[model samples]
Target chain A: MEFSLIDRIRERTAQARDDVRLGIGDDAALLAVPAGQELAVAIDTLVEGVHFPRGTAAADIGWKALAVNLSDLAAMGATPAWALLALTLPNADADFIDGLATGFAQLAQPYRLALVGGDTTRGALTISVAVHGFVPAGKALTRTGAQVGDLVMVTGTLGDAAAGLRLVQQGGQDDPRSAWLIERLNRPVPRIAAGLALRDCASACIDVSDGLLADLGHICAAGAVGAQIDASLLPRSSALLDWFDDDASLDFALSGGDDYELCFTVSPQKLAATQAELARLGCGATRIGRIVAGEGVCVRDRDGRQRATARPGWDHFAA
Target chain B: MEFSLIDRIRERTAQARDDVRLGIGDDAALLAVPAGQELAVAIDTLVEGVHFPRGTAAADIGWKALAVNLSDLAAMGATPAWALLALTLPNADADFIDGLATGFAQLAQPYRLALVGGDTTRGALTISVAVHGFVPAGKALTRTGAQVGDLVMVTGTLGDAAAGLRLVQQGGQDDPRSAWLIERLNRPVPRIAAGLALRDCASACIDVSDGLLADLGHICAAGAVGAQIDASLLPRSSALLDWFDDDASLDFALSGGDDYELCFTVSPQKLAATQAELARLGCGATRIGRIVAGEGVCVRDRDGRQRATARPGWDHFAA
Candidate 1:
């Protein structure tokens, strides 16, 4: 039954491309790389419980599965070229599987990422996707390039997705604005163009899948420097403020996860040029922090004093 | 806790090449690709009950998890390049995770597949890996490449892995070769080199993950051709005979899966060249079948007579 079910899905897809050289039957699939380009690769896993609710909407599950993987490629400053999906479903539902595939095809078409190969089997519901993108040799974005005295910047507003999760947990009624926030939670837009644009000017960059503080800590750690983010400089969306009380507002921005925005550092010398470049791309850049000579991350209010507490972020194995 | 865990792992490994551009602690890792190569990517998932036993050795589970995805790249005729591992352990087991990493690093050393990025989370026992490889453009192997009348060939021997699984499940006493076959069951070496060797010669290719009949049926369906497999020519290891009597022996050879071997088709004119290439690589190739002009797969015995059977191969969800 599993074999037939897989066969049905495979039957509907196109066979291996002429250039594929090898496809879904052997120990591996092969591809012919065109001359003069390096492959950009990324992998992400969506477990039923860890990444999503057990009984969430199947369509949204499929959407987020592809979205996160694309987010990784975006962080690399590469244009998504191809993807392979590995799915484990508890039961054979032709409709559900088809719908999932439909969602993937729709998302991929916009990015021009072809679905090349994969494997399927019966198990707890899990989805893992590996994406391949192409970039000119030596052009990818990395986390180690930042230098001391670099200005920090981010895309999109923080804490909205986290706020949306709270609303869903609290059973927020179906209001239009809440729906938009929920949409942000379920369907994150990978900043592909923004990443491509920042490839040259940004010294070091990363996507804010983790909280702003935690994700920025990564940049500072990798670049061998300290960072100071001014709390006053943090961007807040009115929707988030409306949803959270004063005390919770800061917490949401500081500790929230699942915000697929880009946080990057550029040389202080490039500050003017950086703003000009970002404005050309029609995205605003906020100076939230600067890289310093020492290590560890520090946060200060407008008055410019350090406030210390336990680490603020999500941990997979948190008790 | 997760941040510290990542920091520890990063510290343990030496810094990567200058081309790494960026490393851990960022939202995404960055890389610089050398000029003139295309990337091949694949992903695989191992669930507790579906892919392996609930209590399989942790080391073996880790080994198989990466090996399976590596096999997918091998089938594509690409050189292994990089990998991202997403692990969902019930809880952090420093020793177990270390062992798993060791298993993966050991296999990867031979192929030079760099462990670049991944995420860890708490959930049911599951391991998902996405592997990326590189090939020249238009050189990837695909299931749709088979032409009418291509000679079908397989690597190494079949049925050994199946017999090994039976030994493990039934708790049989040790045979001289028990360890050998059990190892094969636990860690099937993907035909990485053999796959690359055949890139220029084979028209269509696939890995024998499912039973030979079922997997080959995929090639036929994808290539829009029929197949005739010579049952007598199918490679049967001597170790396989110990598990089943005469009647059931055929079943193991035909339907027993998990060989992790390559099954591919070459033109008759190229068969000699392909065989010579395999010999040069110290690999084995068995001429077990031929692609035909019609639909469905047929089996032929020593006398060249077709055999009739009510069923063929293992079906995961078979009632």
Candidate 2:
């Protein structure tokens, strides 16, 4: 049973990685880290109903499972190289494995990421992926480096995934706008290239998995500084703006989770260069705010008055 | 929610590892792999009711979750280092986290295995652990190097965990023998010292998670060799021997899973040195078989006659 499942998953997710001395089918994978590099690792798990609604397509589950972890590497300015997956399911289904593996391989192939090792078990549907990447020593982007007066920037749009989740939950999928938003929720594009572009210049970096306010709050907490973002400047896709009112869009942009975009800080001096680097990758940055000498993230309205703080983002254990 | 969970886990699992540049507070972990060493990675998942009994202590679950993955690293002759945990629980209960984290830390502390990063999600009770370890380049043990004349030896005793599992299912835990057996089931040691000892000499190695015959069969399959074992020579713990008859004990020793002991092949030329190496580590090995020229594993009776093959090991996805 184990052999067959591994064979099937391998058939779909196979990639040639010269550094992976031994890939799947081994007790543990052996990988060689290139000289003069630090290894950046990240792991995330997706559970049915909790991470995604029940009956979500297996392919989507697989794609999102890997995307979220790769998003972490992207947040760290790491080049993804290998991943290990632990998939738990109600039972071993060939078609499910095929779809999931295909989806995983689809996202992994562009980065030359190899599925090194994984375990499959019978249980509630859960997928855990651990990613390993390479970054030159001393150059990893971290959340503790934000300084006062640094410009706060974000890659791509923010509220599309949150809007997508809302439309899917409301059964409002008839419109093309809904379709686009739903795709954002189901398939978040990890900004790996943007992370690379920001590595040299970004003062601080984090991936927005939880809403912008909550994740930015992490940067604030780490650096012992605060951030003030203008709500009027939050980036939102056209589809999201067309589907929701201004107030709703603003709220979603501030607190909608599942946007796998990079929220980073850059010294004011490097703003133009950072913007140019990101532009070359076609994922331009939007200046939403600046680092300030305070605590916790503060959102300012169009009138420059602070908005009343809402519950930051979706809390997995919130009552 | 994520911060609190991380803080709790970090408080319990913290170790002063200078190589971990950044840990749980960031988007991902940055770990410096030692110069001239390759990284070995392994992942495993445990689900309530499937991997362990529903009422199993959170501590045991925690210990076993990390232990099983460490067992994989042990199979590769790697020195354990950092780990990432993705925990899925039905609800956020403080006491459960305390017990689980305490248990996980208890096992991890001895190895100085730091918990670097992870995700906590809401779902059916499950724990997935990914371990990263370092092995000197080109010296890591693998399953594909066995020769036809190599001796098949296993670290420590077998059948105790399997026997213990049987006793628990039968509600026979009132006996001291049952108590010892259950402990074996709950906390099977991942013979790190034995693995290190075998690194220089063992031709092939695998961890006996799915019973010895089944796991040794993996070595055979990898090296395209066969094996023959004598039932009479199989090692069984005193508690296992005292509680079960010869036939039952032999069956458990042969096909009982979750042992987490190393089953490896050593050449005849290195037998004395290998024995001395393991004896020094206090996890003495016993030789029960040898690799042969052809096909699947064959069992031999005490009388030197062929015995019929039984079904091999536990299959997680068996229908």
Highest-scoring model, TM-score:
2
Across A1-319, the per-residue lDDT of candidate 2 in tens digits comes to 4555456656765767779988887889999989888989999999888888776778888899999999999999999999888899997788888788778877987888888888888899999999999999999999998999999999889888889888878887666658888888888889999898788999999999999999999999999999999999999888889989998988888899999999999998999998988898899799999999989999999999999867797788887
At residue B220, give the lDDT of candidate 2.
96
TM-score of each: 0.88, 0.98
lDDT of 1 by residue, B137-210 (tens): 66778777788889989998887777777787777526665776778778889889998999999988788777
Cα deviation of A205 in candidate 1 (Å)? 1.4
Q: Which stretches of candidate 1 lie over 4 Å from their true place?
A: A1-36, A173-177, A276-282, A302-305, B1-37, B136-141, B144-150, B173-177, B200-203, B266-280, B301-305, B309-319
In angstroms, the error of model 2 at B58 is 1.2
lDDT of each: 0.74, 0.89
User: What share of the reference contacts survives in each candidate?
Assistant: 0.53, 0.94
Instruction: Choose the strongest candidate by DockQ.
Output: 2
Which regions of candidate 2 fall more than 4 Å away from where they truly are? A1-9
Q: Model 1's DockQ?
A: 0.45
